[model samples]
Target: MISDKEKPEGTPKILPLCYKVAEHENIIWVCDGAANVGQIGHQIGVLLTNMDKARMCCTTAVAAGSKPHLDIAARSKKNIVIDGCGNRCASKVLENAAVKIGYSIDISKYLQKVPTLDIYQADVKRIAEIVVKEAHL
Candidate 1:
């Protein structure tokens, strides 16, 4: 179990249980790749989740064929996919599993892709705002 002491100061001590409440949640799946856009996409997911606008789930688990995660995606009210670039890796994972995606966006459209993990909070907020408006979150 995760302890509050282990989490960052401003982070939530406990988050909404995504699996148990997926049917009423807008689930976010982001590509956490080794690039600026990818990192920004990930932060955007986290931002939306922390703001209670959506819940970010494990795209890696879905890619690895986790049945529980796949079921959660299947039952979610909306699946919001955020991809780093034109690759659309996160979206493809859900599509391959036959999971319906209610909303999807490629971060490259808003930011230039760079081969670095470093990202800015400003970019995250900017992209997150776009997602909230576009995805109707």
Candidate 2:
């Protein structure tokens, strides 16, 4: 039997692209807009500290049928998807097109009990720390 802490043999601990992008120090990070309302956005920033730029997709454009373009965008470079909830709209959009997801961070499931933090500069920094720690980045 496998231990809880053990990952399947050959499975990468971090996203493959994350490792690849980290090598260049210029990868793009993408976040779902659902997470833009509060500390989640800030947390994303923290998680993105290792990247060249981080952008938020605040609309359903990709989910609304622009999946090809989104896939194209994701393919243009290493991509990490951060979804605020488990609905995983962002991951789904990319996965459906057979695109590989470098990393996926779900905030709703991470801080299940913490009260919503107001979307502020400080809050963003705080949340970003949580995300970075969780991702071990």
Among these predictions, the greatest lDDT belongs to: 1
Full-model lDDT, candidate 2: 0.49
Task: Report the C-alpha lDDT of model 1 over 1-137, residue by residue, as the tens digit.
Answer: 11112456787547878889999999999989889999999988877887778899999999999999999999999999999999999999999999999999999988999998878877888888888889998
lDDT of 2 by residue, 38-125 (tens): 2464355444542424333322455565754554445444445666666666667667656666656665664552445444555445
Clashes of 2: 3
TM-score for each of the candidates: 0.91, 0.49
Candidate 2 at residue 122, lDDT?
50
Residue 95 accuracy (lDDT) in model 2: 73
Best by TM-score: 1
